[model samples]
Target: GYTVHTVLEYNYVLAVEVNGSVVGYVQTEQVFDSAREEVAQRINYAGAGEESWTVEPSYQIAVGEQVLNENQMADAILESSSSEIQSATGLYVNGELVAVTTEGDRLRQELDNMLAPYQNPDDPNLTVAFNKEVRCEDSIYFTSTLVPVDEIIGKLHGEEQGAVYYTIQSGDTPWTVAGSFGISVDELQAQNPDYDFNSNSGFPVGSQLTISQAMPYLQVKRTLVSTYQETIPYETEEQQDSTLPMGTVQVVQEGAEGLAEITQQQVFYGDSSTPSETTIIDRVVVQEPVKRIVAMGQYVPAENIAYLSDGSTLIWPVPAYRGISRWMLGAGGKIHGGVDIRANYGTEILASASGQVTVAGYHWSYGNYVVINHGNGYQTLYAHASSLAVRAGQTVAQGQVIAYVGSTGKSSGNHCHFEIRLNGARQQPRDFFPNK
Candidate 1:
């Protein structure tokens, strides 16, 4: 078959090829010169500048017979002659290659400059790092996506069609903002620190609330691990006082809540709507809880609040268990609802307090578990059991073998999960066994 372009008078064209595949053809000298200039301008980049060359420029150049435009010819030239251009340093955010730059040193300096404000001089513990998995890679890039540092910063905070804002309404509040956006107040406060949320008047109406943040592009995660003091709520303990008037109460000892020293790990994210994770590493009671004793003249028999476990009533359910692995509220401040006692598989799980077996069956989280009701608003639960020695509604005594430990359900290893409930509220089992 005779080629139509070959028969034409101006048949000689610049056929651009990259590694063997023809990208496009430059039919005119003017198109070729313009394309070459554009390609040179695009590839000759300095990493120190604001323009970021992130990923390779995507090309859609038609091969042969098709007349290439300026952009298309430029794409062809860039694709064909990349070895003459400088290599681009890629910036990967959270494992996704986002941007590239030729000025690697300048990019690194800019990133450092971006994160410099997060350092706390007064408290040296304040450490800030990229929340996303960020890394720099050196490779050849075709990215002609040039932009200023500000736009690149916008990219760091996630540029979803720019930023989104919520206009304050007649009854808009921080709490309401959280409800409307399905976000927490902490996240909202983090996003808008300039707003005086703690002021008595609060934010005025018609204010623009930044619902979606446009903060530093580092996607920063600021962490502070410190030991702080927190107040421990005082529990009221009532007793019979014959010296006081009848039907009247008096505080014999001025009740005061104690203070506890806690070592906690706190994490905060910038430019993200995600909630922060808090973990309690260790806690020590600086002061114990004081009971507000009130004396009533009308003498009535006192209810046995601690009859089942008198602050030391419940016996150790797993005698051969190694130790407690997890405590109530141990997982990042989330409710664990129980204490995990590390033990050998098939180890005997004894009843902590004498009670009737209320439930002995399989559960999604508990696996083969047993629940014992001690008849006095007190209940003990043993979970992740391999087998049950007692059935539901059966009577069991303290120290009696009720089940055996196993890694079942949501359990990670062979262990006995124990829980103590007072009037259906989960209590710290550590309080029941003071000595251990």
Candidate 2:
């Protein structure tokens, strides 16, 4: 219902006839004026002669032509909408064009397969679906285009703008970078072949790494109404006791962990790379926690361990182990006043010098620890012990087994935390040991 005009040659196309003789042609209006003026001069030169001109129409497609309307301009070329013309299946994610594949059955199968991993065989209440509504649309294509199934899937999983390079910055580890870009480490290594992923060393800063992945356009969302038991941590309570000695604590009751029944909705998106998130629907405590009760002593009793001058010097607490993982003081005067001696688990921890056990109990920083006072305003503390061989107010001879080494409290591994305090002040123990 509209007139479609096309220009073959836009420059000049006008036929000029002077006295029935074909002269030349001009296309523009200004050029036509000049040709007319020449024709008039020729007419004047030859009296009784007539001059006429006719516009020549050309119908050719070129840069000067305006054929397709604004609506059809996006196609760049007009497509046939006849009954004989057919289009393939188009995959769309949340109404966006994901891909167009020739095999509709295969595309639909692939979409169904994505949801298979999210299905729970045991849970009837589990609902698995696409996080973004995805569909293999039939015959929605306005153009004659068909992509291979593999290519369609690749494009569907790739970034909309294709591959890009990301500059590695400070604190940009492989895990953090991959998570930020929604890519996996294997995908990262696929592009960077030179990187040794097995090594623990980090990549250098100011380097460029290729990032070429996106979360699959269609994400399988799994929602399950689940019920599970949760743990309730016990609380610690301390009471004052005047009958016991100072720097000593006695446990009144042992603590026990409690349980709670929680009903929640577990929502997981995509594969195991992404963890399931929980939303508590209902919660009820099955068993209440029993608080840990300990009695803190206020009095230092008149009774004390008798002193003997048989041994006066300090002895290596952990025998057969000479590995000192850390020192008491570092360069530039960074002082922690304690040393970490690495040893096997359950290794004997001997008393450095003869003294009375002042503390043989649990501490927040030093678990199952022991502290001995050696009468001359000097004391020694052995922390992170597996078990105590001596208790508070008990006497231990020099080099006697007082405890066993263990990785407890805030320790990283099996190590003995040793420290010496002079009148309640911590001192450097580097010079106190016999070995250099």
Candidate 3:
């Protein structure tokens, strides 16, 4: 079907068809030593006494319906020669040959091995066939597929977004550099595909590392500020004790402002004199009708006290304890039973515990008192109250407002007398309030 003409110095052998057409050619010298020698010897014998053998140059061939151009044909011939060389010597380029060695015969052999099956046209099992239909005049035309060059180029370049640049500085490592800019090591590698951090010379100093900027979501918050005012009554105790003339002083009628009488006395002598040693005896309140009154002993300084035990001490039932006639319990005499919380009229009184209101009405010496029996063997009394909001047997929670502070019965001034009794025994109120 075909004849081969071996060329000596050119290192090529030509395959000629029966019609004297040169089908293809291979490089014989680039193949194996034995094949090259045999080809050279045969050529010498065949052309003995002749100037040269007439060898047709290579021509294009139609493999299937697709035509292989000159360059593709030449590549195919080179690959075939490399394959033959590999099969003969069990090595690409036949080891000592120089022609195929310059053209990377080992790499060609690898590619040939990879593409060998697709190169064969005669073997049905080795070839892959694809049919494409074309429209003709009242007929269907089928031809082999021709892939466009642009499509091949497009396939070479894959789908991916581009990269950004970040400069490297001192104390920078691959991990730290990527982490500071919020990028992954894999992404960094993809951005600069040629980066070789392992090699010292690959990424030089002052070089930029390409990365992608990271984006995140956020939220907003609002704040505000304001201010206001209120009026509260103020009272201070006189520092000293003194007596003033108690005769009825003339009150000023309408449109008359009275003048205040001034008097001072030495209550403490020499080095013993202090600010508390003397007290104000009389004071005047200037108004539409001016009035004046005599003041006696200064009120005691109010100090917050705590009981040493586990309960609160109660306030005495009387506003002032100077008039206590007898003691109800033992031989303790007519001593004051409870402390008085001096509050202005209508100050709210709170319940000490969660309990039911046992007594909320009036009593002889106790006045308009309310007694609450707490369930845990504890009871509290609020006496000298102006009014009670809770009724008898009504349930009350702890810290609930029950009444207002007032001087209702045998009391001298407006105050709340609070008392706490545990299992019918009086206990000090300061024990429960450690900070007071």
List per-prediction Cα lDDT, in the order shown.
0.71, 0.66, 0.46
**Mind giving the per-residue lDDT tens digits that candidate 3 earns over 1-436?**
1233333223324342323444344333233333334333322332343225322233332222322333333333333332222211111112221111222334334434433433445543222211111111110011111123334223222223444677877767777777877878776776777788767765666888778633111101111111122223233222233232111122222233344433332232112224223344444443233333223332221232223245642222222323322223333213545446677677666665668999999987767889998776778888888998899999986545678777888788877766667788775554443233
lDDT of 2 by residue, 65-115 (tens): 223222222111112212212356767677555556678898788767767
| Candidate 2 vs. true structure, TM-score | 0.36
Model 2 stretches astray by more than 4 angstroms: 1-122, 134-210, 244-250, 262-284, 299-436
Candidate 2, position 187, lDDT: 84
**Arranged by TM-score, best first:** 2, 1, 3
lDDT for 211 (candidate 1): 78
Global lDDT of model 1: 0.71
Model 3, TM vs. native: 0.25
- The prediction achieving the highest lDDT against the true structure is 1
Instruction: Candidate 1: list runs displaced more than 4 Å.
Output: 1-88, 139-160, 165-219, 241-256, 264-282, 292-295, 298-436
TM-scores for candidates 1 onward, in order: 0.34, 0.36, 0.25
